[model samples]
Target: MRKTIALLAAAVMATPAAAQPTPGVRMPPEIGAAYGRLGKAMMAHDAAGVRSVWAEDFVVNSPNNEVLGREQVIAVMEQDFLDYKGFRKHITYVGQKPEVTVIMGYDTMVPIKGPGAGKQVMRPFTDVWAKRSQGWQLIARQATIAEAR
Candidate 1:
């Protein structure tokens, strides 16, 4: 047991630090910053701005279990323009270590005034952002129903 432990430690130490974690698993700060841009754009309901952060070939697996490509996704956003008045999103990245992973968050819309002022409706969502040659772009996303999960 002692000999095996020594060999294991030696093998681990032999590997380079940059390769210490799994391949492509390194989470760079740039990715986080790019993700922030996405959040801000979404919060602002800037359809063009949101699409700008998405890869041209972006695809999304919606909570409805349908797959939508870039144009379709944007179309949905355009529709959302008709539906939502104003909203905010609270995003929390899922799991430890980035790699390619799902980012989860809550989408909330609050009534500013009138009879139901301050009332809010919240929806949960998940998104996948990948670092490509052009930098971080949203490759996929989904809106989730908590109870159904």
Candidate 2:
């Protein structure tokens, strides 16, 4: 696939760097800062800030459908905030693998008004981050909505 090829190319290009992080290794501060900013943006409904952490070619699949590209993701994020008055992200895990790290988290959003207002909704989240030349880039993400207990 073209996307696969491009990802491979990017990975290959990053291989020769003098400071290549060991594959499958975990780094706390890097991922921590990432999630920190992500949380901030989500709470503030800052679509631009949220997209800043994602790669240009990022892709996300939510309960409804798939969002392709950074721009699309931003649009979907904005819609999410508009639909839910307050949303919170809870990071559950950050697993390291040979070439990428996986982040597992859950989000809860409280609807402000309208039909779903006053309801608390939860969504399980996951992200696959790759260490690129520009640092950690979130390449893929997926989530499913859940009923809050």
lDDT of each: 0.48, 0.55
Model 2 bad stretches (over 4 Å): 1-27, 43-48, 77-86, 113-115
**Candidate 1 local lDDT, 39-92, one digit each (tens):** 555445566766667888777555445566777655544443212235444544
RMSD to truth, every model: 17.7, 11.2
Superposition TM-score, candidate 2 onto the true structure: 0.65
Candidate 2 lDDT over 25-70, as tens digits, reads 3446676676666556655667776666677777766454535566
What is the Cα-based TM-score of model 1? 0.54
Give the per-residue Cα lDDT of candidate 1 at 135: 68
Best by TM-score: 2
